[model samples]
Target: MDLNWYWYIGLGVLGGGVVGWVINAAVQKARKSSAEVLINKMREEASKEAEHIQREAKVTAKSEILKLREECEHELKERRREQQNVEKRLSQREEALERKNDSLDGKLKNLERQEKEIELLRERLNNRENELQQSISKQIDELERVAQLDRETARQMLLEKLKNEVKNESGLLVRDLLEEAKQKAEKESRRILTYAIQRYASDCTYERTTATIPLPNDEMKGRIIGREGRNIRALEAATGVNILIDDTPEAVVISCFDPVRKEVARQLMERLIGDGRIHPTRIEELAKKIAKEVEDDVYSAGESAVLETGIQGVSPQVIKLLGRLKFRYSFSQNVLQHSLETAYFMGIIAAELGLDEQKAKRIGLFHDIGKAVDHEVEGSHAQIGADILRKHNEAKDVIQAVAAHHGEVEPVSLYDVLINACDTLSASRPGARSETTELYLKRLEQLESIAHDFAGVESCFALQAGREVRVVVTPEKISEGEAQMLAKDICQRIEKEMNYPGQIKVTIIRETRSVEYAK
Candidate 1:
């Protein structure tokens, strides 16, 4: 039994084992299948994940391409807009250039037309000038033919005829006018001068620079010529004069250039002869006394002139100068007397001419006052007189008359004219002044010579102390009218060539003689 049991158990055990193995194998196989299924599932899952990742990548790439295309389109549109703006500006500039060129072409055409018109005007003007010149030339030729003479010959003939006519008519007219003027002036001048001369009658006294003193006797000469001529020398030295004690009959001559000094010496000698004192000291004293007396005499003469002329305003110094004129001499006439005569004549003329007589008298008195000091002063007596008057406060009219009387200054008033006329009339009076025989003959010869210098003059003679010239002309050479003209021409020529005191008459003589002797 045990055995059987053991075997069965063993077999049971083996069977169990075998069954367990088989189940084990089946379980392994099931596990293997599960592992493989898991692996496959995992692979499949991985593959599916990879495919989804690939699709996502493709979608992202497509979106990026679309975005790039859109950006390129926007950039191209901006570039096209910029190109259009550039083309529009270029077209506008071309149109403006074309318009300017058209306007310039029209202006150039107008300027060319104006230039052509100016050229035409110039040509027309030139043609007109040529036509005018030809017309003027034809007119000149016609005039020359009608005159039947050349232009120069016709002009000379007309001038000659006109000259003759003008000379005759003008000569007649001038003669009539001169005759009328001479009639009026001569009547008035003669009346005035005649009345003036009749009013004033002045005495004529000739003044000499030397004096003759009559001595009581000739023996007084030896006393005058003290021992060795000391007395005569002292007298001359004291008096500035020469004392001549000659062998004449009771006479002594005192010589000096100054009339005043000569008078003083004469008086001194006379007094010395009377006093019988002949020394140098006594001679000097007497000279001084005589000089003082001469000075008193000069002042007294000046006072006398002032009183005579009735001019009350002259200074004492001027009066003294006037008194000095009493001893002065001019052309052999006493200056004081000449001045008095001039003053008297001036007064008379002034009365006739309705001028101031007193003023005229004053002018005449002072006119030659310069002659008193002329030896000491230089220059003309008229100018010196005027200066002295000015220093002494004389009137302007008086000074001017004095100065103009000599023509040293221009005369500005009627006083100057009247004074000059009076001076001339006074100086030119007959016997007022004398000339030598030689001068008178020479003047007459000069008059005849002047008349002989003219043409057609046959002979000439000076008559009436050369106051008239008679000219004889050839009758065949000079007509009556020409003779009259010749006389006038000779008169004018004489006036120009000669200087005379008065007017000279010219007489022209023409004659035709019909003389036949029966033989």
Candidate 2:
């Protein structure tokens, strides 16, 4: 049963195989169609994509072309603008160069014109010089022919006439100049003198020879006289003055011709009397103490004088010497005070005249420095002061001023003249100096005797306290020129004989007046 069934199954299997083959072929065919359809759709899609890609590439190419075109246009526009700026700058340079060229041409033309003008003027001057030379030659020839003398002689005569005329003119001119100079000098002298006197009015105090020291009683004199006049002798020796012990009851007299010594003695005596110890040792001690006090006072006085004069940087030694002058009396006036007053006057006048006030004050203040040491040192105060100033390395102008103040040397600077002016003002002021009756009479007699010895007989009178001497000369005996000559001779005699502080104005008054009186 299984075999027959196998055969039937095999037959069915063969049929089924045939059917299955057909169906399989159909399915395969269907699968092949479906693949072909898919391939076709993919091809169609690819063609569309390729076309879109090509359009997009065309659009990109167009955009690139537009961008390149815009860049090219921008570059062209910038290049055009740069070219315009360059052209405008070149035009400006060209205009500047043209103006410079025009200026140079104008300058050259002006220079040429100036040169031509200078040449024409030179030509004219040369022609004039030639004409002048010709005229001078002709005139010389004519003068030589007219005069019998040679050319040189005629020229000399003509020169003589011209010289004479010129001399007369010059003489007149000189006379006018002399008159003007005299007037100016007089005006200036009066102004300077007036200013100097008015500015310095320092009071004068005379140091008397007899110094008074009031004692408590007469018993103090015995104590002052010490054990055997030993105290008085020691005091006199120490002070360089005379100590007069007398019966004048309550006062002791210190006497000396030298005012400084007298002052020192008086001060020492007063100190000793006040101390009430009158032994020789005590007298010596008091003398030294008083001397030191006097020295300190002198130094203070000197420093005060310098400060009052407004001078600075003076040497201490000079200051000390200046202080010593406070005790010195010259012609009854305090010498140091007088010097300070003179310095003030000089400084004021110097400031007014626009001169060096420091230099003028320095000279005036130091002018009397010699007076401090004059008692110890021998020489003219002016010369001594000059030497001291030189020792201190003073400026030459200052030294010259010191030396020339008293006419010891020729005054070289305005400061020298100013010092002399100050000195004169100080000495010549009223009540500044005094003379004894004997000395005044002697000076007057001497002056009159000297004037009487002159060639022109004249009566002389000492006027203004011997400051001036007026001589009345006989006009009949002395000619006008002789009167001037006689006055000069008398002045010379006075200068040679007398020792005076200032200049004496010499006035020779010669009047020729004819008088007819009807009665």
Candidate 3:
């Protein structure tokens, strides 16, 4: 039984092994079939994808080729249009050049024709000139033969006649022109001057410088002397002035070159006399006090002048110098008052003439500033005033006006001339100045002598206190025109020879008297 069972088990084991092997073989075959089917499907999908890619590439290449072709066509069109425009512009420029060439040719031909015509005309003129020259020669020969005089003699006679005629004509012309000019200028100037003077008027009052101080008695003079002239010396040293204690009877004369110093000394002497304390120390104290007061008065006067004139920017040094004029005098007229008067006159005249009124007033006020220091400086007052103004940085016009105010320098502008006129007006007004009888008579004589120096003057008289000179001329010797000329000549000589204030009027009187013997 064991054997049968073992044999059956072995057979059964072999059968199972064969069945397992067959199952393995079948499974391998089935897996191989599925894998083959999968590979075929993958191949089919890959081939479809490759065909789609090839179609897309062909379509994209076609579109890109069309775009490139379109762009090339556009660029070619643009190039063709630009070439057409260039050809059109070149043709237009060629036509313009041809037209210009034709015009230039025509102009050149016209110029050639004109040049030829001018040459022909020049030849004709030359022929005519030659014929005229021959005719003139014949006329000259005939004239010399007819007159029975040489050419030179006839020419000289004609020349003399022509010279006489020309002299008369020129004299008449000059006289007419001079009369017309004088009438116009005199009318305008007279109108302006009369208007200016009428606008501003001052009194005929004059101020005189007082240098002598009086005391109560002679004892006051001795007390002022004070112990071997200690007080006088101290007073002089303090005031920088000279004290003249002469036998003038209870009076002392204070002399100083500086007007301000002289004024201070005068005040100190008066104060010392009034105080009755005439000693060295007292004098020193009084001098300082009076000097300070006078200085203040100077500044006040100067400031008042500046304010009255309505001018600005005057330097302090200039104002101080101007104030010194308060104690200054010219021909017994107070200089400060004269300056103010002059300034007013200048302003009025300048306004009438349409000039700078303020500048004119400034020039007038500072015109005579040199007189304040004329004693201390070596020069004319006008020159010194100019120097002072220049040093103080005044305007060039103002300095020039001041310098030329007295005619010391040539006038550079209208202001300079106006200052002279205004200054003369202030000084030469009625009772503005005074002189001794001797000087008055001397001036009159000088005026008469100057008139007599001219020919045809029978008698000359200085009337109006030397302000005017009337000349009587012989009518037979001096004609009407001659009298006018004589008057001018006399005036010129007087102006050149003499120095006097204001202007002098010269009147030439031509009169003829017929003497009859009725008896």
The best candidate in terms of lDDT: 3
Tens digits of per-residue lDDT, candidate 3, 139-241, equal: 9999889988888998999998787566556656666887899899989989988887788777787688978998899999888888998988899899998
Residue-level lDDT tens digits of model 1 in 1-519: 678999889999999999999999999999999999999999999999999999998999999999999999998898898888888888898889888889889889988998899899899989999999999888877888997777788789999888867776776776677779989999999998888888876655444554788888888888888899999899889999877766788888887877788778878887888989889999888788879989999999999989988888778999899999988876566788778888998888888888999999999888899998887899999999999998888889998999998666889999998777777777667756666789889999999998898888999999988888899999887665667677788888886778676568998888998999999
Candidate 2 wrong stretches, greater than 4 Å? 1-180, 204-219, 237-240, 246-262, 501-519
Q: Count the backbone clashes (under 3 Å) in each candidate.
A: 0, 0, 0
Instruction: State the lDDT at 278 in candidate 1.
Output: 89
Task: Give the better candidate number (1 or 2) by TM-score.
Answer: 1
Model 3, position 509, has a per-residue lDDT of 81
* TM-scores vs. true structure, each candidate: 0.61, 0.60, 0.68
Candidate 1 global TM-score: 0.61
lDDT of residue 495 for candidate 1: 65
Answer with 2 or 3, whichever has the higher TM-score: 3
Report lDDT per candidate: 0.85, 0.81, 0.89
Candidate 2 residue lDDT tens string, 132-159: 9999999878877886568788778889
